[model samples]
Target: MIPSNILNIFTNTEPSDISYKEECLTCQIMGSATCLVAGAYFMSNLPFLGSNTSVKRNPIWWKNSVKGAGAIIFALGILRGGEGWLWNQEKYLTNESK
Candidate 1:
């Protein structure tokens, strides 16, 4: 069985009366933060948190791979932003008409 927390992520246990604005805000915040953090790591060599902290120690292919992955992640976050906003809009309209 899937863990409760993991399952909860796939399900919305919130009450029907909850506002869509709140949900959208939560999603946007989470997505933006994730993308920003990951993109920063991929593009920099700040410290231990950065994947290229020891660029000289690692190989060229690995660095390129990390950058590619980061770009994909950032794009996904953009898609998520649109999805989250649209979901909230649809839900809000449906709820209002009910």
Candidate 2:
């Protein structure tokens, strides 16, 4: 499971006192969503790599492998963005409270 702090970074609602930055929000959401989807799709397929399932024998296996590799890369993006989001949100909130 993703850590709560990290998930919070990707999932927080906009702060009420803050001005909305559409570009930032859109980028964050899109990046995170894309990363999550790609990662999940790839990671899910990874378990099948070693399986004796018919999928292993299919030409699709090669495609799946490629996708799996892409997913890992995307997942890393999610991690990076998630950390940044959390940190920024924390700083914004703390400063606002002062």
Candidate 3:
């Protein structure tokens, strides 16, 4: 059986208990890092885009488009990573809880 702790990382909803907060934080950080790396990779021209004849026809336009997409991904990673600190009950609890 998959452990609740492990499962929680993949799920979007937080558990009622705060015990898994650390795991959630770690998951977010890792996800952020992965996104950032992927963004960087996409932004870079290191990967050969020449495989497709169409891409070869307009390399500059394709590179710019890819870079723009990478920038958006990088921004999303930054936002996701920054939310790690807001998981506490005091900050995250709804108004109904107050």
RMSD over all Cα atoms, model 3 = 8.4
Top candidate by TM-score: 3
Worst 10 residues of 1 by lDDT: 44-53
Regions of model 2 farther than 4 Å from truth: 1-23, 46-71, 88-98
Which candidate wins on lDDT? Answer: 3
Model 1 superposed RMSD (Cα): 8.5
What's the CA RMSD for each of the models? 8.5, 12.9, 8.4
What is the descending TM-score order? 3, 1, 2
Instruction: Please report, in order, the local distance difference test score of every candidate based on alpha carbons.
Output: 0.66, 0.65, 0.71
What is the per-residue lDDT of model 2 for residues 9-87, given as tens digits with 9 covering 90 to 100? 7888877655643335567677878777777766665545565467546467576676778778676767657754566
Which residue pairs in model 2 clash with each other? none
Worst 10 residues of 2 by lDDT: 16-25
Please give each candidate's TM-score. 0.49, 0.38, 0.55
**Segments of candidate 1 deviating more than 4 angstroms:** 1-22, 47-56, 84-98
lDDT of 3 by residue, 36-63 (tens): 9988888887554565567656677777
Q: Worst lDDT window (10 residues) for model 3?
A: 87-96
Candidate 1 local lDDT, 17-93, one digit each (tens): 54443445686778877886787677554433554556677767776778877777877676667663555477656
